[model samples]
Target: MSSIIVTNIAPTITEQQISEFFSFCGKISTISLDHNTAAADKSLVAKITFAKKEAAETALLLHDTKLGPTSVVVEADPTAPAPAATADDAADGELRQEDKPRSAIMAEILSYGYALSDKATQKSVEFDQKNGVSTKFHSFLKDVDDKLKVRERASATDEKYNVTGHLHDTKSTLSRYFEKALDNSTGSKIRAFYADSSKHANDVHKEARRLADMRTGKSPADTPEPELASSAPVSV
Candidate 1:
């Protein structure tokens, strides 16, 4: 009945690992790892629902605990009610507030691309200041630069297509554009950015549709899977 939000989970961590880590506190009913929430950040956000409220409170003590090399942020999940729809949303026939116009969505996506690029750059600078730009910092800088490059491409693509206003319902066209943009890049990091961005967009579309379905009473709410029975430590 109680849920906790776990943020800054290392990309190397898996659902099984998270389940086992939290199982030590008490019975875990479900664990939902939402990588799509902030794909560009190279982090995972998980919603851990405990069978008992006390268990959730217990798990909160793990806040700032090291999940991998980096510490994680854990807090009680704020189950805020969905926002009320405006007259414009009603006129647009959008059942949920998240179902915005295609151009609006693209604009938001572009903003996220820029924000993530800036975040990576800032982190790299901070790391260099702290570590004096060691070999590890060089590698980190390279990774951040690669991510920024891909995000720039994604932002450009989104802006171009947003002007054209033709990407609303055409997944194939979007895929083709992404492919053409990434054709010259052979690095794994670049490929990962492309994949993650595409997946994130698709997930947003799917969730919007799901919310519409729920509003019409056509589909039931998504249920989280039961926790797996595993106590083994998560492999990095």
Candidate 2:
């Protein structure tokens, strides 16, 4: 679970040179040439997953000793066992506070399973061919869609039933507006589209009531009104 990820590697370092550098360690997982053939402007990126952290550290130390200009960083999987604590370290109450269970950490990071799924959805929507919808981004988009649906439903219920509830729906709506605007590589046009669509949906609901009133010969003013906007923001 210990991997050596070499980035900003000097152009002079060839694939064979990198392979030889880590020859003392375990097998390499992947080595990729992420740069073009501009000698002074080339950078090689390689990922080497070792059988053990010590072996990986040995490779890093070797790089530090011989390859002075290159920069390499090691990232170990969170689920992997932490580096062995020394005897003096044992004197400390806890070896590490960040070593929470991987599942629990992932749960907190994802917050909701659908949120991660929504990221995948966004990727999909970005790469779609037929409709040019990116299927890779679809998971993320779907998760967001699910969350909005739930919030919208809750808002409608709370407003119609005269019930009190936290401002989650309003906050979620605004959060999505900002998040979409910020992350979309294209621009804020998509955010504007969503905002307009939301307003349109609410308008459609009102229009339906208008039609019903006309058919029943009732006054349009008889329809119940929407609630006022909330004043404060909410957090995830």
Candidate 3:
């Protein structure tokens, strides 16, 4: 028996409907539908084993053919393991600092800066929560300084790389706005601002990492960021 895999099955499709549709081509020995339970975003896949290899070939020829409202992609089932990476692949993977694309490197640097800012904000929250009113002011000031340092580094890197003018202006404007807000904020407002900023910074970092990983072929295009460590309450 030979197998043909069909993908892009609509959610409304059923095993019986798939079986009936393929039965017109040839006798189906078995049918297996992979319902992705891990995530709701993924599409379903169906593996149809045909009694004759000729039937499987016939199905393969139906690639990109419509199977309802969507165009279904059909291909022969993989019978062998993927080939191991060769030396050339390894050589290409070891990218030097100068060899890396300027845009990618700039993105990576910006991500690092965002990560630093997030870390500072997180620490500020923890410090405020741990120490009473006596130390909260000091901690807030320290956090502001740390965040400004990160922003300064990112701006300098962007200037060195001659990044787009709009990006530079946007970053500078946001940084100044955030600084002014932090200076005026106190007590709960400070914490709230830091929390919101941290969340946004982490999101940007995650997107940068996702894009970098995709370019390097280290992960699938749809892969999510690895689980982050749980935030724990700090005690002084």
lDDT for model 2 comes to 0.36
TM-score of each: 0.33, 0.26, 0.32
Model 1 segments beyond 4 Å from truth?
Answer: 80-236
Is candidate 1 or 3 superior in TM-score? Answer: 1
lDDT of 3 at 126: 41
Residue-wise lDDT of candidate 1 within 106-130, one digit each (tens)? 2222222211122222332233234
- Report model 1's TM-score to 2 decimal places: 0.33
Q: Model 1 clash tally?
A: 0
lDDT of each: 0.44, 0.36, 0.45
Q: Candidate 1: which pairs clash? A: none
Q: Which consecutive 10 residues in model 1 have the weakest lDDT in total?
A: 227-236
Give the TM-score ranking, best first. Answer: 1, 3, 2
Which candidate tops TM-score? 1
